[model samples]
Target chain A: MIDEHLLDDLALQNGLLEVDAKLKLAVGIGAILIGVFSPSPVAPLVIAASMAVCTIVFAGIPARVYAALLAIPVTFVSMSIIVILFMTGGGEPLWDVHVLGYTFTLTTDSANLAVLLLSRTLGGMCSLFFIALTTPMVDIFSVMNRLRLPDEFVDLSMLIYRNIFVLIGESIAIHNAQVMRNGYSTFRRSIDAFAMLAGMLFVRAWEKGEEMLVAMDARCYDGKFQMIEEERRISATGIATATGYLCACAGLAVLFRSFRIF
Target chain B: MHIMEGFLPSPWWQIWFIVAIPFLVLGLYQLKKLFAEKRETIPLLAVAGAFVFVLSSLKLPSVNGSCSHPTGTGLSAILFGPFITSILALIVLLYQAIFLAHGGLTTLGANVFSMGISGPIVAYALYVAGKKASLNTFVNVFIAATVADLFTYVVTAGQLALAFPAPAAQGGLLGSFSAFLVIFALTQVPLAIIEGVIIALVFKYIIDVRPDILVKLNVLTQNTVNRIREAAS
Candidate 1:
């Protein structure tokens, strides 16, 4: 089992991580918004392609890593598209079939809708992938802090983020031990083992929480978490380039919508 | 059973965000009260949030040689209330969106409403009813978890169907909803059952090993714990 934590570490090591987090955040949000609100598939499809290029080329993230990241969402999105495609009703029937006394039909309208949905979803996903590939959660938190989100909420997120790695490590050790003992040999045994593991994890997490509280108190800890924000030079040129690219994407979306070139 | 990113249209996703914001506010208010009452609960809540994250991601072998992930929210909803569970769900969903890319930020509101608000509300309701009915702890937990899991998917189906209704079915929304419900049910039913059993067993173990924690959390009274012990013996 590959350590899931390694995924974030890989993002941190990406070349684009050094880029201003605000820029990446803006690009990501801009792409998603354009993808979602666009009237035609042409713009979203273009955005998807461009975002993928940015993530793979500009970000210097490996193509394989990007592909692996997309595989799950692609599978799920495809399933959903199929549901949209096979939904009975609307427009001329492209294909009709009977199965188990129920008639299934593929209509032109449904097909069009599915195409639009697929493009939009892919475009949005690519934008998100770019952000996940480039920015670490800590930086995102820093941005949130800068945006003046409540201190408690930010602190809670930091605590949860730190402990998630710890709990994952503990879970991996317990799962390995269970596997060595043939804990998952049968369905019944797997359930038993899983339940036992979850119970033990809860107890361990609870104990860890108590210990954390004691440790914090020992340092005269207040109810606040002090975060050290790194000073990054926000270059005007970088911001200008990012804005230009986003404006171009928006311009293309507008042109495509007005032209209706599907 | 997350509604993937870009799944809901602009108005629909925004509507869900608007609908879900109140519950999130209420949850924050509850957390504030809890923190004021017991500062130690802050770390405990963080740990609980982490536990939900780790537990939900675990894949367990299911009946018929299939595999599925557990929601892990019903158990927490029972331990903490639905309001707090909603906050936990928000954190878990955010983490999954950023780190795992399992869910998307745009659809976060919809996902949180379905899995966090609707499921936990139903689970907590069922748990309270079961306890009042004097049902066995294991059976109650099983019912709560399974129903809660099933309800989450049902709500997701509804959200999708509402966004994209089928023209063929006379009642557009109803028809599309049934179509999605049938599609999700094929996988969700068995998964829900498996999750239910897993949570039940875990609840039993907790009752056995650390009833004290439950008592402290006000989930169980001292008299109830003694009765549980007697019944086990």
Candidate 2:
């Protein structure tokens, strides 16, 4: 979702705005449809398949990169499934394990449910991953601003997006320093390093906040972070293309609603 | 609770969402005033948001296999009052819904109202009580945590009651609420404790190191709070 180098390169290149707008429209429409239409089992599968096609078509990155990105939410889904399967004990137990005077039953329904839930979540994540991969981060901020999000929130997001790379670098450097001092091979040391990292981040962020405030004041900063909102004329061809894609999605949604596919 | 799509009846969720939109717009408009007055506060809000997002990504074991992240509602409430915290929470929830999928659009309202409004109000009230009683910081935090956790559950219960039909055995409002509480309690109590501890530590550290941060954040007034402390002591 956050590729700093790609974002910087795209921002440098001219004609990126038009590309971003079109991609934004496609992603916006798709996300809305997914949110509204894909409420059941079959729709999620269909969405997943469509997302797979979109990933292949739109994502310039390799399949492995996509898979690595998709692994994040996939892992989360797996954890949820495992927890739910063990806890939700009902419907003709497939297997029962007695542990410490407690009977843990795993049912066929639970297993099926875990798969269903995992697939649905993975489908959503994959679709989102592709959307983020295709759309640059700065363009997303522009879209959010254009979509009438509050200026403060938009500005906040932009700043966070901008500084995230710097912060991540700083965090990595700090981690390396800590590791060099004493290797965090032990579990306790690893946790201690994490806690130290968090505390350091907090302090750094706080100091940065003060410095940023002072810098803004020094620069004769007004309260609002103003960016020129360029008015772009929407070409008829672009509108037509976007409309066609939107109508197809709407059609799919209507068809699914009528048939109760998901 | 991160309500999934289609979990609630479409009509009900749609209705609340519709109702929520106007409040959201109105709230945003009202927030415009605050933005112009104190632009520096934006970074503070951003820091709070970024910290919450970063810390939340680090999931800690709570109960069983269900993990819960720090809501940071108490801290937000302590710094900014509940009213502003509501708007901040809504914005954060919007980002989370659109970007992370941690929470859903339909359920954002209920989540905001619970974590944003109820948690802080309860925490602040507890803090006030603790102040009056001259209680220690840890005691104040524990009280705040317990009250805030209970308050959110109660509000969530009401929401469940509204969403589901009545009668305990029918697997409707009461039954669902009970089931949710039982499931939620497994993680929520521990999550609350973690949050309480973090907030307390942050509060203590801020008081010692950079009291100016809290002062600028409007969490505590310099002279008034000092006077109160001196008198209490």
Candidate 3:
């Protein structure tokens, strides 16, 4: 429930909501691939910056929410890159760190690797967030079906997607009840409370599952779930802008492959 | 430890994608067979998956005065068996990636391999072994959960080390492996223990409330169910 409203709610309300899903998908997936494949940090940094603009401005997602979301991956990537910086060595030493009986130096090569890794993480995450904040799972599921994925898989996924909100709401209610009673006042009590929540949630989910089956059987369900495709034609200008941005990023990557920040 | 997007570089991510596909197909195959035999289980499985998703989002209080999230693989593997759990894990990982930004699409394969496939396999195997040995059920579940959680992180560390080895003179793969392990395993051990305790408690509570479900699913034998009932009484 902590993140209950932030994801799909924003996507549903995005400025790009009425735009063609395929174009958005292409932009997102293509940017991700190009970002990940880029060798130098410059292209990835550029990709990340542009994605921020697209997600924040074009998609009309809240800047504060976007920054908070970016923080999660940035924190993780920064911590891991520190490990890379300390462990690898080559070229001129940039900084020396000593721990226990050994000295670890951050060398030029390691620094470059760290920057590359960080930039890639930023670029990839921004592109990913762009897709996530713009395209909802329903659109992706419909896309999956159109791609000729197995019907059973797609159907199960739709069911799962529908159920996730149910379970999230259920768990939140349970947690609120527990909090009211001080169920988590202590470490031991918190564990007990959480386990109890999980147990109760599982039982309820099982019952819901059974209820769903009965309802489906009552309707005489066959294997088909109707997924409608909205006719939102892709505009030529949209195509031009997307390709222009992607090509600019790709060209920057090729041009800056040998450029080093440090 | 869901690897961040583009963290594994090119070759490693593709390699993991290749490795994770067979398990996905196998899970799908098992799911289809289950659907044919029992259509009701399909909805149950779907709901159970969402249940896992919510379960993992929970912040479990640990003994070390810190809170962490559960992987949900241990309980799921026991309840649904490993193959189906893999599919559930894959979906859960995808949701975590999309909604939570915990993992990403390109690294989805790597994340699936570590959290979904490896953790569940370890948990299911250990649980089977414990049952075969007639080990104490609660204790067995605890151990299985902890070890499986730890092993998933270890595999992740190995994957990272393989992708980015240190200088050969500084011990290369082995060197970076331990470094990443230090970063993950240190904070993870206590968290893993907390996950284990919670998982066991969840299992115990399930047996207490709806022992019939476990018995019918063949997760617990009649003898074991009787033993649990007798012990409870």
Please name the candidate that would achieve the greatest lDDT relative to the true structure.
3
Model 2 lDDT at residue B105: 50
What TM-score, computed on C-alpha atoms, does each candidate reach? Answer: 0.96, 0.72, 0.97
The order of the candidates by lDDT, greatest first, is: 3, 1, 2
**lDDT tens digits by residue: candidate 1, B4-115:** 7777887999999999999999998898788778888888899999999898888766565433578889999999999999989999988888887777889999999999
Chain B TM-score, model 3, reads: 0.96
Best model per TM-score: 3
**lDDT by residue for model 3 over B170-195, one digit each (tens)?**
88999999998988766688888888
Tens-digit lDDT track for model 2 on A1-262? 0221222332233233345454554654464445344444455566666665665554445566555555444333443345456554445668877878966567765565555555456555555544544555555666787788767667767655544444555566777887788736664465455555555656677777677778778988665577765455667776676666556555655565533211
Which regions in candidate 3 have their CA more than 4 angstroms from the true location?
A1-6, B62-67
Write one digit per residue (lDDT tens) for candidate 2, span B68-133: 566666666666666656666776665555444455454566677676677778887887777677
| Each model's Cα RMSD | 1.8, 6.0, 1.5
Clashing pairs in 2: A40-A262
Candidate 3 chain B, run of 10 with poorest lDDT: B59-68
Say which prediction, candidate 1 or candidate 2, comes out ahead on TM-score.
1
Candidate 3 residue lDDT tens string, A1-262: 3543438778888988877778888888888888888989998888899889989998899999998888777545665787799888899998888889899888999999998998889898998898889998888887888889888788888888899989888988999999999998987898899999999899889989999999988988776688887767889999999899888888998998888877
Q: What is the lDDT of candidate 2?
A: 0.57
Count clashing residue pairs in model 3: 0
Overall lDDT per candidate, in order of appearance: 0.85, 0.57, 0.86
